[model samples]
Target: MRMSLDLQHLGREEEALQVAEAALTDPWVRHGDRLALQRRVLRLGKPPRRWRRPPWAASAQAEPREVVVSATMIKGAAGFKSCFVVPPARNGSGGGGGGGGGATGVPRTACVEELALLHYGSPAGGGWRGVHSEGGVWTTLWALLCWDVLFMDVPEVFRSPFQTAPLDLDTDAFLPARREAVDARLQLIASGGAPDLIRAVWSRRVGTWCRGVNWERLTLDDLLQIAGCVGGLGLSVVCRLLCEDAGGWRGGMPDLLLWRPERGDAMVSEVKGPRDRLSDQQRAWLAALSAAGVRAEVLRVVEAPPPPPLPPPPRPCAECRPAEDGGTQQGTVTTSARSCTAGGKARRRRGAHVCGRRAMAVPIVCEGTEGVTGGCTTDGTGEGAVVAAASVAVEAHSGMEDDRVVINDDDDDGSGGGGEEDQQQLQ
Candidate 1:
């Protein structure tokens, strides 16, 4: 039985299946021989019971709970896979292991946190800085979401804000004002202030939270869902600003500018309302803006909501192997010693597997203050010994070619502070 299991683990599924199936055909077996053998060998049985929906499923008020459940389930699956496949090691014991040493040693969480820092930190120079305003929050949210999706990182901090115990808006006037202040700060940064405000917020909120979270546990779809939430907020603001019915500018607020800095112009004017019901004055303003390089237009926010949830991901395909005769085959199969020899020929005919290809090598040149001091070839196979030897040879040759090379002015200063004595020794 152990031998058969080993064969299955080695991807010889067909051989294991044959061994198990053959055992059931033995004449010594009783009336339930086949079923008993299958139970013992393959562990075949009825599937487990399906999960029951929570009681809140029937109420429209339960939507938030449902969304939480959906997001949790999706992210949980990824987290489970990450933990199971790449469990944290005990100190540095596993550090020196070679290939196929359980799992790759890459630190998934650290990579994600670095990516998030880069995304938020890049916009710190010239543009906006001040207290957060509604508009500024929306802008930052949109940019963060877009960069998050484009770069493919956890974006979990954004989702974390929504999951925190729901805010009591009525009791907490400061909560709304806090969001507004955040927006105003972003506006100041956008207008011209340094990114210090953004850096401060990230250090206080995002950086602190991310330090403890393992980002590798989050999936691509989880990040996308967060982005969708941010995008929805942006869409809400855009709709409100474009559809307002007040004709003349009663407030000191400047006309809404649908600016597209990427395109070097304003794309549209949103007078918040019905497209066909635009007043004559509003229409004239839109026409004038359009002619003057601003593409002005208004769009109404419809009352209809979006569609239902998407289906869960499909299950992985069953493991299988090809027959020795070059014929298609299904199910896990273990090859017999005779069949193994035949399969070798068949594999050769099919061409070398992708994993066999040697990666190309590239030469890297190291430059110092003195000049291009050395060069080394890095073979894509990741053999550090070879790289080190090449690097040493290059350095040795470079040093021999120019024995008097002075790489830095700091090297001239001796710790003893005897500058004249050092100079005399060099001469």
Candidate 2:
């Protein structure tokens, strides 16, 4: 940060601004340092002001976002190896590991998480802070809390608020006895004795949470489903928030809350990206959450990477061996070791492109026999098979190569009986 200022002091205004902007985007920099750098970048500009949203999104400021995963895809092919095989994750591959690493098994999951950190970007018309929005997990956490705290029918007294709410009961009282007893907290809310307390705490955070809980996007059934996975972590997280100084903690929150459906395991997860830093508010929330016995984690999500490519299929080549009867004969009859397919017949591919057509043109190298026949044979008859393999006699031609000569078997209809035939050169 001082360096950028120094650059500016030296009359390198543009260079200073450049340094500030670059520093703002580097994730490895400490969160505090990155924020200072961001401010520096803005201040270095023509007019010093906080960053603003793009012009187009100004109209939609009033809109609340739906708390659902948007349909997305892996658009990058970088480090993309193969298509089918998934590789094991590299150690420390994905992200800063958090929580006790419980039922969430394996590092491949980490690899997946890392991939996202490396690539995800938002368009110019994206969330206020780059592409990612911090307060993302608010709903999932709320939904979980609702499930836990409202397990038994929510007391009618608790549902509606009164003038002198939370008269006697406060977080100080609630935090003492049922502090770690998740069931006790649930029972207290359900029995209606703690109406004022529940109301007070819930109300404290409701205004902030409402920003993300989009009613239009969540169906009644979806809410019901989410409610079940809402566990102890959910309840404790909100209580921790309500107990804190609201002024410091409204917007600095984690982005994701995840749960395993089968076990109902839950986590308070944060996505920390490059050039991104964990804010003090977020750290305070996490500390409070831990003291309350809630499971908290800093996690990441990423695109599944591709596998490595296979070596190019061995190039088609020929191996030759000496033939019988002195003068050589040649044909490397490569056959399938096993049937290529079963039931459905394999379609015969057309000939390789050669000889100015979609077929090979071979010359009959009549070394000693009269003539050779060629064409595919079936049921003792042939078409496109190398017919009647006869060792045709050939006068030692002057312009012949020593190694095997490639010739088309007798696929042509012409008849030349081997005696001094002007051997048309085999292509």
Candidate with best lDDT: 2
Candidate 1, residues 1-427, lDDT tens digits: the string is 4555677789876676557657666753322223334443433212232144323223211111000000001123533321111113211112110101232444333221112122112232111111112133323332232222212222222334433211221122322334444354435534433233333443454522221132233233332332232233333333222222111211112123222222233233232211124443344344433433333444332222335799985432222223454433322121111111111100101111111222222222122122212321232221221222211111111112221221111342222121221111100
- Candidate 1: misplaced stretches above 4 Å? 1-166, 169-172, 175-191, 194-296, 299-427
List model 2 lDDT by residue over 32-77, tens digit each. 3444565456556644432553332322122212222111233448
* Residue 223's lDDT in candidate 2: 37
Q: Global lDDT for candidate 1?
A: 0.27
Q: What is the C-alpha lDDT of each candidate?
A: 0.27, 0.37
Model 2, backbone clash pairs (residues 3+ apart or across chains), number? 29
Q: Estimate the TM-score for candidate 2.
A: 0.30
* Model 2 lDDT on a 0 to 1 scale: 0.37
Error of 1 at 77 (Å): 40
State which candidate has the highest TM-score. Answer: 2
